[model samples]
Target: MFPFFFDPTMMLLIPALLLAMWAQMRVKSVFARYSNVGSRHGTTAASVARALLDRFGLRDVPVNRVSGNLTDHYDPRDRTLSLSDTVYGSSSIAAIGVAAHEVGHAIQDKLDYSPLRIRNAIVPVVGIGSSMAFPLFFIGILFRGQMLMDLGILLFLGVILFHVVTLPVEFDASSRALRVLADTGMLSSDEITGAGAVLRAASWTYVAATVMAFAQLIRLLFLRGMFGSRD
Candidate 1:
């Protein structure tokens, strides 16, 4: 059976969940507001990414348009920058800012950012851990097998570690994006402020995610009676 809704550890996780909800709202609000405002230079997100990559001597890194609202990302494996539908061809400030952020990841790959490198290395393991954690835990509990439960907790730790490491990677990308935008004068001061607002809001979501993962791990530990004399 699951823990009670009002259990102490469960209560502690409420704030993190609320913060995550708030972060989601903020990201959507800022993106929606700025997505309507066109940039002064009137350049599409794809064009801006290309310009930044070229400026950074990364002309070989390709920028490709992808389908989705906010599915933009940089593929380190292939060294490609993929922008979403809203960002790829749009001339809005939000689009350009998002494109720049993904390009920032590409920059990190090129410069061999240590945290990013570590994140990439563990991605496959994290993927497996995330998917198997809950199933293993539940199956172990059903069979009253301590070893299986322990193994599940161990795998779940990898998921937590991935989220923890992701915090720095995301923040660094945003910092790099803002710096590049400023140094190149690609966006006016006011425009940069707007873009910064959007990126900052987006970064909060990552923080919320990490907090949520930590809370989940702690809750699992509590359920496993890891806290002595608590059961």
Candidate 2:
């Protein structure tokens, strides 16, 4: 194995990845149990969001439908809460739970949640850093330019930080989701507990993705260092 491959930095990755994958499977299964398209709760996603926002004093936020299942998100820039077509119209526990989760983000925004704020601030930086990091690192290694290699490492580190920071944001959203749902009686105790499990599992997807990204970063770093040393 390459040096970086054996590095202890990957110690937490394996479990995190496995947990994340497991969560994905669990969430999918949970959602599958209620996949009927005809189910209706008579309450629109917009209504749920409006009510929740009003309770939290965030009535200015607009709730709208967006395409794609589970693609729902709260966009802070436009102060909009976007939900999937299924989630917006469906009144199932899953739909309400998910809608509340996205709205939890809005709550986070309103409360100036630290992790969410940091994640948002780092978004553009992480994008640029991740994009240029590996390529620059490789070029640096090929050309025996330590500066380029170091810069790449630094950039890659930013991406890693962004990933690390995302964990709390996601987890906090889930926490907020459960609390809101229970507080609002959107879900019964059993449903709240069940939905919490699903959301927890869904969080693993992010964990897994972060692990995969970190793994790739490690692999690249190992290759560069080994090859560069030889050169």
Candidate 3:
């Protein structure tokens, strides 16, 4: 039953998984190195964020610390920038770099970035679709229900669309991070390059996830087309 599920086309999906794993591993490695290496630039996360916000004239946004490694992000909902404990207090280049990336999201939100707006608009639908799509597809197969399979396909499409839109939002955030870091002198030239490597590795994880989502959608489509009941 699962043989076709693991065919040559499925093998193609391996790279995406590897890429995602590689990205996560790279983040971990960087964190390990910087966990003890204080930022050579001598700036605290709060001060760095405050300086950047001041530059952008966004002084009202609050920056706070949240628990978790590399779990930093800027919430547009309550206008808060949440940083993980390590990133919020640590002075490593990696810490500062990640913090800036989250700040980049805040900047995008402030300017109403188009990709971010689209992503936010679809979040609810994608959330529902992702949760139910695969199970529905499998149930449709078991019962040979064409309606169920089609419904699964529609929901699966939402997940894919979210992944597609996510690519740009992520890339844009990294772009913003690099520019800000360079302009503000948060990192030395070598440090900037290292941060770039880290960001690129992180971006590939999203790429991998998108590929996996697309592959699952295609697999479902094929299964439905070939074996779906006519009734």
- Among these predictions, the greatest lDDT belongs to 1
TM-score on alpha carbons, each prediction: 0.92, 0.84, 0.89
- Rank by TM-score (best first): 1, 3, 2
Candidate 1: clashing pairs of residues: none
Residue 9 displacement in candidate 3 (angstroms)? 7.9
| Tens digit of per-residue lDDT, candidate 3, span 21-104 | 877787777667755556677787767876787788789998888988777888777888888888787777777777778888
- Give the Å error, residue 99, model 1: 0.7
- For candidate 1, write residues 1-231 as lDDT tens digits: 346334566776898999999999999999999999999999898999999999999999999989988899999998999999989999998998999999899999999999899999999999999999868865765666666777888999998989988989999999999999989888998999999999999999999999999988887777667422232
Order the numbered candidates by lDDT, best leading.
1, 3, 2
lDDT of 2 by residue, 1-231 (tens): 445335554554676567667868877887666534222345665577778888999888988899987888999888899988878887666677778888889988988999888989998989999899978987886688878887888888888888898899889888988898788876678777666766776787788778877776776676566666764
- Lowest summed lDDT across 10 adjacent residues in model 3 is found at 1-10
Instruction: Kindly indicate the candidate among 2 and 3 with the higher TM-score.
Output: 3
Winning candidate number (TM-score): 1
Window of ten residues with lowest summed lDDT in model 1? 222-231
Give, for candidate 2, the lowest lDDT window spanning 10 residues. 33-42
Error of 3 at 26 (Å): 2.6
Q: What is candidate 2's CA lDDT for residue 216?
A: 64
